[model samples]
Target: MENNTWSDDQPIVSIQNVHKSFGALEVLKGVSLDVMKGEVICIIGPSGSGKSTLIRCINALNDIQAGSIKVEGLEVHDSKLDQLELRKRVGMVFQQYNLFPHKTALENVMMAPIKVLKQPKDEVEKRARALIEKVRLQGKEDAYPGELSGGQQQRVAIARSLAMNPDVMLFDEVTAALDPETVKEVLVTIKDLAEEGMTCILVTHEMGFAREIADHIYFTDRGVIVEHGPPDTFFDNASDPRTREFLSQIL
Candidate 1:
């Protein structure tokens, strides 16, 4: 299908004929999608459909066998540029809150800016504290990851990604590990980020959140984008049979 029609002005991320393989298993096949600046786009599909792989490739976590991924007009797969710098520009939040077990929330959030970016201690602390407050974890800054609840830990992870001030944020099933009660808090934090116009690409199964917050939704099946459109169009009147069936079961 024509996936490019949904393009708005200039795309912040572009994947063209992308393919990824792990050993003998091929996970992604000729997948192409565009994400506009400041848009919140969610990729939804059945397990092992390459939704996570696609997002990983965007930030160079997974190397694709073929095809090109461009982020902020820079080709990510190109060896000419520094991968570390590329990752700094494209921050990622994982399914499990990957905070250091020994580090407190504040330290977890401050680590990257201080170590990788080499920001001064005072500047790092200032920015990290502000971000902790932004995610509604003002007092929990000193709490170690072991002491925080699942949702609270995930919020810390989000704050950690924001510490880098990335242009694009990639969320790979961020709320999948949370209890239902805790999911809303994390989703609320994400919603606030969306409202603030952070360019985000999320891999999620939360249909309700996708409908309410996503600027666009991409439905993938068997390593291909079966259909893609605005949330109103895709969720309400999905064109492809695979998409329709998937939505029916979830809705």
Candidate 2:
């Protein structure tokens, strides 16, 4: 197991005693994690284990009721923190390829950099083209969403996120919508990013992929992180009964 590069000196994203809820349902309970710079972390658990909520909270997409989240030293839970700036620093990709119907692939990738970031059109276009190519979508830049396959659309969405040039990338079940055959292409693109030292936090169920690529794995259960370790220790020597049961069912 070649555990690759990661910085332990400074954490890029920090989650401390994070607790979130939806009315009576508490989704995340006292979950804590510190993702170092250039680290790749895969979060695995059954549905409704607060994995998605945790990732959302990291990007300040959802507010945490208790505890705090900090991204690149910006306190996410602080009322004074500019969520706009936080989002620019933390890019997130949802499972659904939320591309606009009227916009072509290149347009979809360039829009955010132009409108939101206020980057120059020519500069943004240049960056967008590079991002699209990086995601392996060079040939289909002008194609509409209707023209691309689900996997291709997802790749476009990934390129769209990269266009922002965010410091941390958060993926929430990115390949969940793609058909089994199409899943590999999207996974390959993600793996490439991970290998290139992008600080990434993934909420996914791809156990084998996680084992192969993740520097660390966090197993969440019933709104808590029940077990966590590097891939070797987390995958092969799970200490908790819940972790063992989950691995047995999934693996």
Q: Residue 34 of model 2: what lDDT?
A: 92
How big is the positional error of residue 151 in model 2, measured in Å on the Cα after superposition?
Answer: 0.8
TM-score of 1: 0.95
Q: What TM-score does candidate 2 reach?
A: 0.95
Query: Residue 237's C-alpha lDDT in candidate 2?
Result: 90
Candidate 2 clashing pairs?
Answer: none
**Candidate 2 per-residue lDDT over residues 1-251, each given as its tens digit:** 02323235768998899999999999998999999988999999999899998999998778889998877777888787777788888888899988887999999999998999899999999988998898888889899999999999999998999988888999999999889999999999999999898999999988989988899999999999999999999988999999999899999
Compose the digit string of candidate 1's lDDT tens values, residues 1-251. 12234233778899999999999988999999988889999999999999999999999988999999988667889887677768787989999989999999999999999999898999999999999999999999899999999999999999999999998999999999999999999999999999999999999999999999999999888899889999999988888988999889999
Q: What residue runs in model 1 are displaced by over 4 Å at the alpha carbon?
A: 1-9
Listed in order, each prediction's TM-score against the native is 0.95, 0.95
Q: How accurate is candidate 2 locally (lDDT)?
A: 0.90
- Predictions in order: lDDT: 0.91, 0.90
